[model samples]
Target: MDRYCRRAGALALAVTAATATGALAQDYVIGVAVANSGGLAPFSQPAYDGFKFCVDEMNASGGIAGKHPIRLEVRDTRSEISEAVKFAQEFVDIGVNFIVAPPDGDPTMAMGQITSPAQIPTMTFAGTAPILTSVGEYVFGSYPADNQQAAVLGAYAAELGYKTAFLLKSPDAAYTQFGPAYFGTVFEANGGQVVGEASFTMNQPDFSAIVTTIQALNPPPDVIMTSAWEPDFPAFIKALRGAGVTIPVMGADVLDTPTVRGLGEVVEGVVHTSGGYPDPGSAHAEFNARFEAATGKVADTNYVVNGCDILGMIDAAVQAAGTTDAAAVGQALAALPETEGIMSSYTFAGTDRMPMRSVVLARIEGGEKVIIRREMADPATMPAP
Candidate 1:
């Protein structure tokens, strides 16, 4: 009996040692839940590519603190809010400390409910300020807010002498509604008049009625400002051109896409604003190069840079926290003062999980987009516009 007991103890000790070795050999798994297979895939794919590139580069450099190689466990949310929430929970269940989500306001907003309760840190490529304001902790956004873009575009329109401007937007989408609301407020405050305003539904195949309504206003507005996603802008532009409404068209960040450019001459001379320019020299040149080389296409102005920044930010926080624990990473992310990234220099401020300042404006000219200006001052510091 004594000999048998000694042999059993030895076997148990060897098993325990093997288990410890296996645990030590395991790599840290990071979750990436994105809308990479839906309507937003065009935007999310580049973001995924960017995150993969950043992670690959980091792993090549011996990974975070040289302790473990980080592995990204990607899940497609299909642009659905429920799917996003489920993926967040799934990631948590799988013991992933970090997550990066897509560019939709609703899905990202839904992630807040999941990650906050579970105490998992989530960074969204979407820039819906209200999401951060409503959720408070457990969520950080890397993109500039739509309201900020609206304010800047409004101020620019005011400067450009577009006193009587027409506002067109999609009433159904929160992102679409918020932009024009903020733009109208700033435009009116800056001595510009929103002479006409109209709202349409998302995925609507035609905007001819909206265009006709705007044109029939007593005195036509000087500039037409668009704040819709999906079929609205393309339809509106095509309808407006068909109706011979040639006034300059302006819009928010949604206009800074290849889709707009693909409209060819219909969208020519349209002005838009973006958080970061898509040029090679803009902060993340290497990222852009790698993205183009890998995807066989130039990067567009979605959240790809923001996604890269999200990964880089996580890496930075991991470096700062010195651990892969979710709580430690959350603290590090919330406490991050500033970090230079591909999108923009991010700094947390005003209880929001993103930088309060740091935005840029871009315009499409000669069938190509160009950065009109960068590093625009925060709204609080700027002259009352």
Candidate 2:
């Protein structure tokens, strides 16, 4: 503890903390860091269940490497970066073997700093910042970064023959800015044009004014793209439809919330690009079945599948390395062959933490979320770094 504290500056200081109640010396410890409530709940909660479900299944199957049983230590971050920081220090002090990081980019990146300093392997499902690739060797993410998501959406629009589009985003959010800048690059490169655009203030309740502006665009576009989150998500869409602006709506992964899915039939022609989409005969089917039985709920979102796959990835890394040593595990993880998981096939590049997988495009039709296709975020359309 004193050694880690000396190494710490603004980073969390390791303090003596008791671990979980299991007495076995060989128990593999995994720290699940999540936000069970607050603004991030919609994304984090299902993800928590996914990680929990996978751990339980692994334990039941006799644990990793067919010997050491897994143990879990969960800390609720409540969607706050401060809380996430505390969890990272506490998990290290308690001697966790690895960490399942928070489901958002900002906190997950911050969490990685603490875990990396402590020599713990940390992987996340929702950290999408392109900068995440440079978070050192100890941290990893299963999804492509925001720029990747933008590239996929842009190319998809061109494939759908949408010649013109209108993009709506909040200037206040960094990811929103990435949406227009990156998506616009690929869209125009593919012969599409942006006719007009609108911006909304973050957290503004009434989008009626914004919707009016969209409705009045001269020569309305073939598609309308929005960069918004949950509470704002439904409000904007409902207002758009109410104002009779029915051009096909496109959005990034932020729209993968109940507000949009809850709209069902009322929400038509809305396409969302996500990490994974529900599909028949998917590698995740067996796990999804067990998940429903255990929790009485289907794995409704990719975060759920992503969470389960997070553990699968660690398991692969452990097997490839043949040891739980954090540094060795990271080295093996970076060199792992393409392995199929519930959400996608993960293959790590030696230079960065981002995994290579197909970007999933989903559509809302007849009031249900359906997987449309597994597509690549082509390198050709990637936004300039």
Candidate 3:
């Protein structure tokens, strides 16, 4: 089956229950709060689908540790802070063993306000903001920290011989703000300079003004970098390309969605960081194949693997703790040794709650995602979160 069709099939299934093949064991209830029909839906939906797929697979294999089944209690936040908080409160009231928070910073923070105090181990599948972990010791971020992603792209830009850059900043979230700043920091350390910068907001209808601003520069920058995603990214790229600004653009992993890729020729040559490549024989490839076979659909977004990795991390933490106690699991998660996941091998880097993993540099070539390189960024060189 095609990717979209397979995704639809998988998403159509109940998020609450998974079919198991053996006698049930002590089941772990995981509360999931994600945006299903809002701006965050593009990423969260696929991630939730991957989460569900993992749960189903685990249950079929006799659940976590081959003895405990997983019960998913899901609620769509609709991309609203109030809704996210409401669902989080509901989960806390019911005392779910763990929580899978929405991927966005605001919603995740709102959810954390509830989950953290209740001492539940809450994981945000793609919340890259470093501050998200500060909500409490119970909160953990599943994706690489934003600064790590920016540093990777920044050093990459310098290595590609880009001497000057024009940054496109965004005030919509910390991911956009700190991401670009760290990019500039690393770029400058490598003999590059940020010649200029412009601020943008999310869902801005027109990027012509930004495009014109870039065009107005006496000598265009060697590269353009941003932490923009979704509507902003597509609209900006369209405007940038339409205005004939062919400078290479660099971004973080959020740009690896179908929306940007669907732009095809317009997004060609744009490079960004990602999780891992699902090459034919690798673990990622096997997981992707399993997802397709189980759902009879293909995963549309690479973020699907983020979901699988979230569960993988949880399973490892649970095993390490030897119990499902939230506090113990949280500690185990932070102390987890380097572990393999569908997307990449990840570690909490010794209690930061940010997974230290290899960054996959990818580019859009001929309207398809192509790998440029994969390397672990040196923490010593990364800007402070």
Candidate 4:
């Protein structure tokens, strides 16, 4: 059975049955608008599942602060911004206390335009663009900003004694556009050189010209870096390797998808920043075990923990504020102390809505992901968004 199909029925009962009987008085009515089918589904589905998993655990533990049971209403946005907006407006009309938004920025932003003015705190599980916070105070992002991921990867590459780097940037989104430049800035600051730069549109059919350009460099760069995701990334890597280019490649969290894992040996030694890795004994590993027990499926990506972390923070904020008033809850969320989340230790204390969290760097070897290290990016090196 589809896990979401089963959970959807239970969610309806939890939302309506308890209130109809007056059995749960202090309930947190939360709205979820995540894509279950569409281009964003690969990332959003697991994240939505994680949110539901956390909701199940919290309600089983007697809910937030042991008294307030959560009532969830979920809608599939199908990766469309219009659907996201419509559902967000419905959530506002029904006066939901909080919202879990879609995975990508455009939908999240559209939802925020509705929810923020209505004073509903909205959190996006995978929208990492730093500017998402500009939507309003009610909006928050669970993933690290693009610059943060770039800083971590670039700093790690320099630490590995890579003296020269080449960047392959994409014009598809802010994530691709800014991430490569930010990486270059940090790499140069660390005494490394950016030997060359190139740009490609998302899903570009050919990389032969780019590969030739890299090969023709007077002294080849020690490593290649990029922030492209999905089909584009895999295609680029395959073309580079197929053309006999052997330079190591480093990237941001965009590489943390199931598609990349399918590359197997092609991705060996590829380094990238991630939300978190489920190494044994880690909090993420523990959560994954529970997730499997609860859903009968293993998480395919670290994005699962991104949703869990967002909900956990919401729980903490609701408890701390002692009420679900949007202003109070929003303030509490922004003021949360560093929390040990399934993803990592995160806090929103000093900035907009972006979480300051440790970045996990991982390498693929033998068709498995191995953690290289976890570190906080240098705030001084974080490029301006």
**lDDT by residue for model 2 over 184-221, one digit each (tens)?**
77889889998888888767789998888877877888
Q: Which parts of model 4 have CA positions greater than 4 angstroms off?
A: 1-22
Please list all clashing residue pairs in model 1, or write none if there are none: none
Tell me the tens digit of each residue's lDDT in model 3 across 229-254: 98899999999999998999998888
Q: Candidate 3 — which residues are off by over 4 angstroms?
A: 1-24, 349-351
Which runs in model 1 stand beyond 4 Å of their true positions? 1-26, 278-282, 381-385
- Largest lDDT belongs to which candidate? 3
- Model 4 over residues 1-385: C-alpha lDDT tens digits? 6899889999998979987765756778889997888767888988888888898888988776666788899999888888999999999999888898988777888899989988799988798887787888889988888778878888888999999999998776767877888999989988999999999987788888998999999899999999888788898888899888889999888787767877966788898898887878988888988999889978878888778888889988988898877678988898888877887888888878888888889887776777888888777889777
Whichever of 3 and 4 has more lDDT, that candidate is 3
Per-model TM-score versus the true fold: 0.88, 0.87, 0.92, 0.89
Q: Which should have the higher TM-score, number 1 or number 2?
A: 1
For candidate 2, the lDDT comes to 0.78
Per-structure clash totals for the candidates: 0, 2, 1, 0
lDDT of 1 by residue, 1-385 (tens): 9999999999999889976765454576788886767666766776776777677877877666555688888888887778888888888788787777777666777777787767788777664544453563777777777666777888888999888988886766667777777878888888988887888887887788888898788788889887776557888899999899898888877777787878888887888877776566656666677777876767665566666777778878888888888878877888888678777777664436755446677767677887788765456622221
lDDT of each: 0.74, 0.78, 0.86, 0.85
